[model samples]
Target: MKRQIITFATLIAVVMGVGFSGCTKLTDFEDTNVNPYASTIPVTQNLLTGALRWLPATVNSDVGAIYAQHIGEVQYTDASRFLGINFAYDDFYRGPLLNLQKIIDFNSNPETAPTVVGGGSNANQLAVARILKAYFFFHITNRWGDVPYSEALQQSDNLTPKFDRQQDIYTDLFKELKEAVDQFDSGAPVEGDIFLNGNPDRWKKFANSLRLIMALRLSKADPATGKVEFMDAKSDGVIMTDAESFRYQHLAETANQNAWYARYLTRFDFAISEPFLDYLKSVNDPRIPALADKPTDGNANYVGMKFGLANTTGIGNNSISYIGSGLREQDSPELIISAAHVLFTLAEGEARGWNAAGTPDQVAAAQYYVEGIRESMKQFGTYDATSFAAYIAQPEVAYTPADAIRKISYQRWIALYLNGYEAWMEWRRTGFPILDPGPSPLSIDGEIPRRQAYTTLERDLNLGNYNAVLQSQGPDEVNTRIWIDKP
Candidate 1:
């Protein structure tokens, strides 16, 4: 009986030991890694779209184009419905500054390669990601002067990244765009490039055009370098060529619908300002009728109000369409930056005296101005082509070199249409075509803000670096000048 008891005890001990060992092994496995309840790739793509979706799509021109010198229609300060939009009326910073935060994040990830996709798998989607990154970054640092760089995209890893000098950032931007453009040299058809329909050659053109913009942004900073880049890239068409433009055609489907169009249905929608309409009228710029469809037509030179103030000012709060006899058009996603603008850049560059390479500044400027004008005349909501042509053919509509630059900036601003902040940025940089500061009691530190205070959220999260930038500039806001911008 004693031996049998001993044997039973030994068996029980072994079984318990085995069970304990198995539990420990399971614990070790659990401690070491993860199953990733979410797929990293899809998660990454969602992150990418999140960044893009944040970019400026016309919310409501009525509120946006207050300083619009191109679409010279509408009159009065809109209620502050477009505070974020008017805050950067030039379309310079907000969209690029905000959305780029995401793009830079995706590009930094080694797992993803960048390319624009029409119908490619996720692996190839990063191309559009890269292109937009460069495009938007160019817009940001150029307007805001010194902005957070090197670590702007390190949201997951580090929150506080210091601002880099605009000069250094521009240098990096040029190099990055050059590198980005070169990546498309694999000339074989890419799987999912949406902007170029998977055409590698077209992607190459976009990269070069982007390079042109980068080069030009440096014009105020380093003219020699800018000229060199301008001349060098002349061999290839600037980004505006039909073969190499970067544009995402909008569709009727809501999934790919325009941002500004959705705003019309919301409480936030407001009318265009008079100041902008007056500017366009002053120049007799033809793009106005196509951009905003006012209910009335009497004030030939009516300009719109500053974006957000109309509601606050109580100007036409109940009026559905405020502009006097302006055309009312359906809303759509206007190009934030265009392919045709690429050619316009070349034209402007030529006018700036860098014309010897291919097209002289004078003629290139004229031709592109005309081409850009024609393209701009295309309707978004509703427009009259004959009226636009009449506006274009007016005696005041001469296409001088200065006029070319003005036209380029104007068209670029109008192309941005409801993308108001960029228009504000261009006005800040080029003093374009010129605009009157609309009714703003708070007037961002006694001046139309050059740069907005970095989001307090960003400051709160990245206090160390954010405070450092503020220390140098003092009170970050619309007054702060971005890197390349020479306000």
Candidate 2:
């Protein structure tokens, strides 16, 4: 009877499963009713695979990077700055916001399992999807502030789902991640588990590291809550070393390649920024040559011009001013999270006098950051090589906790180069290696934008919920503080 009840509930969920017409019955895709199918699991796996495409897809390209460079400035505009694609506010409405909506609608229901080789009845695959779901939602809240939650992926059935406040969403995200982590173990091969290649232990590491990030993010908004999550993750297998890690690898192909390949190979659109170049020049970072351009006319032997701007525009401000060289043959894979980043996170936690997972804040972080620099270099690999530390030993190198968490953050920022979306995020999280003031007509704040404005499409697609979010957030302006903007 209990099992029947559960099945009934699932059916109700399916019947009103928003956009999931394909998931109305488990048997619709697989014969989970009797003998479960292992091959069906990839349906959900496909979702995870597709999601990998996004990090490279939406991040700051040469054109987008220009706006990102000045997101700190206020006058930001699409017409004047040539930043309409990344900054004019349509990208979210059309790209991430919409695609992510599709991802969630699928993960939230059974219809959209990855089209992996295995069957869909595998509990392991579901576990992975749930965790990814949590990560996806976390990204959304981080960027958009409060958003539609409880009723969020319900489609027509949930058209009026009330928007959950950012705080509440954070509350649920940690809980779900915790529950999802608990559900995982060294289980049998689940279908389509490509991120870890079906390795439960690796997935555990991802969960723990992410939990640490979530804890750190909320330390200010809710310190006690943050510590609890922190304690639990440390006890779990957080990526303390290279053994357990996660990175989004890219390819040269359009189907499933690294984003950098697209930005550097396909578009030929971007160049290294002066600010980014100047920062590296100060440290004489060894990775610069591998990562950027070399020209006597540039900030360093290598400097690229701002993308999307043509020097031939005959406009005084035309980018044709010749900034120098650009990134490289292509960029590297997008790092989702790394041991080095985890170490720096701990360092910052300790500097702030918070409890670290197991090791002393300073000791663990120092060792981690040093090793992280090395690993980062490894992440890039020979041509694939990245992270240059030979230069870190210079006078400005070898920083200890005395120099503070800023050192760790600055390193993280450097590690995140080319991967500017994350670089920008880390800057906001730690506020280090302050970017020098630059000029951009597109800035919305006297400085660059602190957050993206709520897109106009939401006003139509999810108006009631969108309005609820706006009511709490106020006008959907770029400067509204989500949960963590303590300052």
Top candidate on TM-score is: 2
Clashes of each: 89, 53
What is the C-alpha lDDT profile of model 2 across 238-329, one tens digit per residue? 88664455765555456765544553353333445556666667886666655653443333345434322223133222221122223232
Candidate 1 Cα errors over 4 Å, as ranges = 1-27, 31-128, 155-157, 185-196, 239-245, 251-255, 282-286, 296-331, 357-360, 379-393, 401-412, 471-474
lDDT of 1 by residue, 1-487 (tens): 0111223546766676676685746555553445567443423444444445544443234333443332222233322421341123223233333444444444455554343222243333445556667666665554455666666654334445677877777777767666655554443343423345555566566667767766766666687788888777776656543323344555566676654455444443445555555556677665565545554434443335444343344444443234322222232444545655565566677778775654455876777676655555543322367765676676556576545666677666655555555566566767775654444534555445555445455455557766777776556665556654653
For residue 392, what is the lDDT in candidate 1?
Answer: 64
Model 1 C-alpha RMSD to native: 11.2
Model 1 poorest 10 in a row by lDDT: 81-90
What range of 10 consecutive residues in model 2 has the weakest lDDT sum?
70-79
Question: How does each model score on lDDT?
Answer: 0.53, 0.56
Candidate 2 runs further than 4 Å off = 1-121, 185-187, 242-244, 265-267, 295-300, 304-332, 356-361, 382-390
Q: How close is candidate 2 to the true structure, as a TM-score?
A: 0.74
